[model samples]
Target: MNVKLILSTFLFGGLIIFNVNALPASLIERDGDTSLGTWQIVGESGVNAMHAFLVSARKVVFVDKLEGNALKRPDGISAISAEYDLDKNEARPLSIYTNTFCSAGAWLGNGTLVEAGGDNGDANFRSGRQTVRVYDQSIGDWYELEGIMPSMRWYPTMLSLPSGNVLVVGGSKAATGINKEAINNPTYTYYPPSGTVMEDYPLQFLAETLPNNLYPMVHVMPNFEGKPIIFLHANQRSISFDLGSGKVVFEYPKLPGAFRNYPLTGTSVILPLSSIDNYNARFMICGGNKAYEITSEGEASCGILDLMAENAEWEMNDFGGTPRVMPDATFLVDGTILFVNGARTGFAGYRKGGGANALWVNENPVLFPVLYDSYAKTFKPLASSIVPRMYHSVSTLVPDGTVLVTGSNPQGGVSLNVKYPTEYRVEIFSPPYLFSNTPRPNIISLQTFEINKERIKVYYQQIVTLIVQVAGGEPSFKASLIHHGFITHSQNMGQRFVWLDVVNVWMDTTVTDQYIVTVLLPPNSNIIAPGPSFIYLMNYDAPAYSGVEVLLNEQPA
Candidate 1:
């Protein structure tokens, strides 16, 4: 049976809605082997994915730079955007006026995908610097707002704030090897420009980091707008900044070993926050170049910082002997970190080959995918893919518990003949949990709303009862809320997985094979940020077959 698109039907209310079986595509029947899980060339992405995010379970919106993609628009221009259908395993081109090269995005609380910034375009492709585009479901396309941003930004990072706005931060006026003082954009601005607190607030931290601070790893904390703290990691240092005042809340100890932001491109994700840990914030950064100019191998270490610890200090873990440069670290539904993609050598840059051009950093694609058990602090190597996903490659967890992996254009301009050419072939990585003997959990409804028919507004600290069905499993149920944020350059901008506090779980007296689970959404939007969140019901240790997408909010969120 085919996987379904629940988010499309329930939230966006789009035209296409697949029948959700609440079960993952069982690899036992389709793929000949299931030991290392399964990998299949599902389909071709019409555009090379410089940016991608799962808009729904059945569809992914792929954004590319204005390049020589084989897919063309209605007017015959090379299309830079496409909507990929996971159900059909095919992609259809969508309209995008500006180039989205090296751009970043975050999902709004209202379910809008707002993407911003890009490089200068040629005569045909319009420039995207200072441009902002939001996905419009009504038109089934993108609505571009050209030059509306306060200033020009090339590779800015965006994060959804608790207040339902997107914060755009730190890019450069123009693309460079490492950001220079003259070209660095050391400030952050917000979209919706109407009720923004600060516009283009100059951040000295961005300047202090200099040369290597492009696309800083900025995450919204549970600081909640009253104090409002955002963790910013760039170059070798990390800082807690007050978004309200542009002042540093706390400057952290400098991370040793390698630079983890742009060019070097180490990936970091705010680790899954659990109630057991008091929802204390923790960040895990993995795989970056030891030096800006090294092509030998990346730093084989991963760093963890506990924000709420008594005396917060850096804890580094040695990545399973093998080093990586641009690996993507994503949280699985089963509460494990899946580190996939990226090359074992080189930085994140475009080049015909390696070492010749200092910025040329693409070689040796790391075929193996590793899962980091945060609880055990050990890495388990999973199946390796045949495709080489480097440079602009991206991966995100879907509703059916599969990792949708696609895109890699080391040299750029979309050529298929070269060694590591622009890769459009999509691959789905099914972790071992899917094929296990454990029973998969299912979420039936949220209050009055059914699984996939209408939008459900879940508020902060509200005890929402989930009607669930599972036969013969441990009564201990857990709820995992996730957002597959805009993924590009090893940064899943705004990607978050917050463990909902399950208050109680009791077998349903009225219905057979059913149970009533009560979970309190995070106290405020700060914990998970206010936006579209996927709620997964976990049965004991096994993963959920699929998730129910709901708009998670606080006040106006």
Candidate 2:
């Protein structure tokens, strides 16, 4: 029996919903068991989460484009900035004066989320269009950075560079009217107001990619020589750009078939790096489409490229499972990738002139989650979700190893009559590890020394010890720094994963039942970019991860 066929039948045949409180241990022990993972409808988000990021270990901040009175929102709210507390399962509304629709953001070294540019709506055009807003997660406050960006950007992409600065890439001057003739700002600028900016950089590449390349897949990887280079891919084209001089180092071979960017939305993840591979980097792009017709099938092809190889070319792999569009692939703490959300047919977004049911062309929602094993090069379909996360939906891996899946608004505004109506319900997918009877390793404390009398910093190549209490056998742990990117429009800008080097592991002599794990930080910023990274500890089985500890890598200024 084909596993995909059986899994599809199990999903469509109304699989029993397992009680969140009473998950069986047998279900958990099924390692790499797709059926063992389960989903629980935790709570409802009051607003549609067009964009989402894990602000803290316990809190998630979700935002949607400004809808004014279209969607019933709290009074005086121009845009919904809802902070969802994972522990409490409660969402609280925060006031955002600017319209943050189609904006881009990345976490700064200070652990503050810096979002730049947004919609050009009339309501808050002055503040929203060109505004740069920063949110302090520690204080639950928002601050505006005045006069930062050089232009008004909608549908822009923001990436955190290895230099601890953010690079803002291609965006249209206006919203959604993307075409060949549309005005596209093909240059990139820096955050924190870098005096020198690269204007008209790679203008032809962005122009040729056009409407489909709104959110380009950009990865900062070390080349064969270990120098940092930016890999920019959109649609069928890919280019390696040198960061220092703003020149194209090399143009990668075209993707085999179908487009993997916006409208034709797929998901991508930079495969986990390891010492065995000599830290050579590879990227995988999966599931997209070439057209927006209802009859158009979602692309089941996956393209991968090894950046460090001498003559690297995209290797295509066909997944004989469900074809998905607008999917979200989140890199889990254990180095496995969790693929969720998106639709089976039709492109992203709602139809402008179609009738009620046909408002959103993407009908079949890929409810089942797939786990991609980078090492094994295989896809395992996991538990299915009842919610249909298409169009503007977003998903991110929480600190505790659960995937927080939210949002799906195909309509331009709130409409109950549409087929795939606007969704505010938030669901949490508990991976097989969470179902295990074995207790997770608990982090007792993280020891860090103060630098510059201003902030705590983890120095490069220094051994850092984390005190953790293990419940069962001797602990064999892995340290990972997962950067949960600002997710919007199928592009997770600045999303990255770095498997930290383990120096030593031994039991704590002073404290019984407790052990100390010593890990070496990346030798330089090029290997693992310096900024805010969520550090997680996973034991031998890789079953569950301890709550994340935010680590800042900084050299004293």
Q: Please name the candidate that would achieve the greatest lDDT relative to the true structure.
A: 1
lDDT of 2 by residue, 305-422 (tens): 9887789988888753779888898888778888888888888767566464354567689988888877788888887888888988999888788889999988777765656778
Q: Write the per-residue lDDT of candidate 1 for residues 1-557, one digit (tens) a residue.
A: 12221221111100111233343333245445566677778999999988898876578999998788888999899889999999899888899888787889998878898999987878887889878999986676998989888788987899998778898999999877788999999988988765543358888998899878888998987654456679999999998988777688888888978888888888998887766656778888888886766456787988999976667889998877678888887778877888999887878888744433334466788988888988798988888899988899999998888899999988757666666778989999988878765467677788868875544778777878787776653334667788889999999999898777666556665676677667767777788877787888776555766788788876444
Q: Rate the local accuracy (lDDT) of all candidates.
A: 0.80, 0.72
Give candidate 1's TM-score: 0.91
**Residue-pair clashes per candidate, as listed?**
0, 0
Task: Look at candidate 1 and give me any clashing residue pairs.
Answer: none
lDDT of 1 at 397: 92
